[model samples]
Target: MSSSAILDAHQTAQALPYLALTQEIEALLQDPTVAVPPRIVQALHGGGSLFVMPAADARVAITKLISFIPTNAQRGLPTIQGDIVVFDVQTGQRIGLLDGPTVTARRTAAVSLLAAQHLAPRRDGPMLIVGAGVQGRAHLEAFHEGLGVQEFWIASRSASSADALVAHARSLGLQAQRVDDPNAALADCPWVVSATPAQEVVLSAPPHSDAFVAAVGAFTPRMVEWSAPVCQHLARTGTLVVDTRDADHEAGDLLQAGIDVAALPTLADVVGQTARWQNAHRPQGGPVFFKSCGWGGWDLAAARCMAQGIAVSSAPQG
Candidate 1:
């Protein structure tokens, strides 16, 4: 049995602030020694899956064990539930366990925000978010806090979910409204985040050039939020960047569009050359599409962020 301190969802989120999480993720991206093995998925008996994702670096290592069950929604339970186990590299001791769902939601949003900070043409306009689920809420907070975004336009298949998300956004003292059609709103909202399950296309129309769209919903080849033509158009005229190489196979929008993933740039590549790319290359590009499939490196970054916060709070002050 491991004697690791367990942090509940709220506590886990308190530790990994959006700003800090982005910093840690960017740091890990730049570190050549960090290693994130591809996630392993095991199908369960009842139409579910068990995911084992691991990532490590010189100082720490983390493994996120999670189970996803679609029927959990009917039971009023979270679809994804588990814990991220963190260990110290030198001591080889289990230091802490964080709420897995919270880490996943926050880290994924942070990754998008990190990319958006670099890719967005302008940050002051209303941001459009398709899907009003956990990722949508997380992305809202990340962009509002990280980039000072004040207005939001939300669209979802479920009207109640969209209204709920809009209310949540307004409660944060931000301006938020519901849009019946996400595609129509794309022209006005330069910053867009598509966080749906990606069963079908949620954003089909071609967005304006210089817009930044972070497609975070579709991870599998079968799931897609953007229409094939939209993806093809973006690939043709705009700049397309993915979160990781794994996206080459997992990002549905890119793969189904027959995009040459190897020919596109990764977020790490953009971050490494932010100045040069933004100045010289971005101007020549049309819209910017950033497709983020799940990555274990992000989970590891969240764990490290949480650990750093714990260390800071526990330190003896003079």
Candidate 2:
């Protein structure tokens, strides 16, 4: 028999192609008959977060519980940690445990890529990153691999972090550099992704002509990664896309801006209304805002991808 082992970060990273995952996500959502929506439970504090998300279909079920400790980075520990449990739908028996961070990173980036690409008029441009933390690195790799972005510009509050991210990108044979001026840098790139945990604005300038932005930062209502003015501009001038209707409860930037959640289109709306958007295309030189708070279905999708054709053990009981 083949060996059964827990999938760690390394193995999880290569378990699936993000492009395939994004494509599969579209295919799954486009089916009008599928009705299993992801269920999520969240607990949030000033510096800590815990989230439980479960998603399933007719054949499989997966649940992932993710946590965050902000001070872990100060102690030379990773800030985010989680575990995913998989089960067989037929028997309800435990089947797999996969690393949560890897799955989260992959699925988050794939979702961001999906929204950004869907909103963008054209996908060919230097991918710009507004933060150089772990999320930034994940998106860098995701956009490069999934969307064929060959050039990168990373701007961060911490110069060292930006340099480190740039080094990692260069190591992968990608042309990358640190942005000294975020405003000027933002004005020149098309796809800008904000992956920070900042309570303030990251982009000091409006996006370049015909640019698209994927905002993945700020979860709580107190945290505002995109400034109020920028958000107002986005609401006024651009189309806003969110991952789910949960934006009303979780997305701080959208909440702080007083945006009408009903007016904001979710990912499903984007797919379902693609033709209408194209037919009613306004002037082509506006910023596109895609805000994401993540979803449980993505974690399930990642788990299935990693568990494909593999054997995994049951959960250890005390």
Candidate 3:
């Protein structure tokens, strides 16, 4: 019998330098067959946080646990920290253990970029990003390195954080600026990303006519990032693509915004083939929103691709 290979966080980190984890994740997003079942999530009260665990595919199952703690500022540690366990589906054996927070940040940004690649307008334009935390920085890196963004507008409640993000983007050889107002930033950029965990509606007003919005925060029932008006605008004009409609209904952003749950289309509908649901339904103008509630299949696919790459790179030359 052959022994299974085991990988720890260090190995996973080393493998990232050689593998295109971002690109692999993007490919999986385009493939409809990948099975990303509903995620398993739990709320922890002491820290006022929630834990989300998602797993997918038996061939290479990857499980990630994400924590959201708003009060972590009182403590020295970060509010969000977790780990990912990669297993071989056929034999039910563990293969890799990854730094959960790092992978989550990378995968989340990659998924957003994939959505932009498919939904955003053809021409490149200024990009506006709300929130300047880990997700915000990851978005900047991914957009700068992968999306070829020309100019960036970074905004946060904290001006210093926003300025820091802008400077980091410049270090990466990209043109960036800091914005004090969310609405002003939205008005300037055609491509917008909201990565905040604000409980109340942040952008109460509707987006510009040509803007494409990607809402990556607010995964739980209590948290909301986008305002009701924005969701309604999306319903009126473009397609509201989501990882799952069930998850969206539970989100406070959509519920508080009073978005008609019945009107929004599921990822299944967009990826599925049927009458009256052709690809033409994809919005051409106005605000098109793609909300991800997190999927296990995406993680599994990414882990499998990474593992395969590692194996190939380790093989001896002929």
What TM-score, over all chains together, does every model reach?
0.94, 0.88, 0.86
Which lDDT tens digits does candidate 3 get at residues 189-230? Answer: 778888875656677656667676778777766678887777
Q: Candidate 1: misplaced stretches above 4 Å?
A: 1-3, 45-47, 274-282
Residue 275 of model 3, lDDT score: 41
List model 2 lDDT by residue over 1-318, tens digit each: 223347788877777578877876776567443334544545566667787777776655788888876667667777789888877677777766778888888888888888866778677778789888888998998898877899999989889999999999999999999997777887789888898866576665677767888888876666678877778887778777788776767788878878875556688777777654454345645788888887777776775665553533333446
Residue pairs with backbone atoms closer than 3 Å in model 3 (clashes): 58-89, 228-257
Per-residue lDDT value at 64 in model 2: 85
TM-score of 2: 0.88
**Model 3, runs deviating above 4 Å:** 1-19, 26-37, 50-54, 74-76, 267-284
Measured over all alpha carbons after superposition, the RMSD of each candidate to the real structure, in angstroms, is 2.3, 4.8, 3.1
The 10-residue segment with the lowest total lDDT in model 2: 308-317
- Candidate 2 Cα errors over 4 Å, as ranges: 1-5, 31-46, 274-285, 309-318
TM-score for candidate 1, please give it. Answer: 0.94
Best by lDDT: 1
Please list the C-alpha lDDT of all candidates, in the order they appear: 0.88, 0.76, 0.68
C-alpha lDDT (0 to 100) for residue 312 of candidate 1: 81
Clashing pairs in 2: none
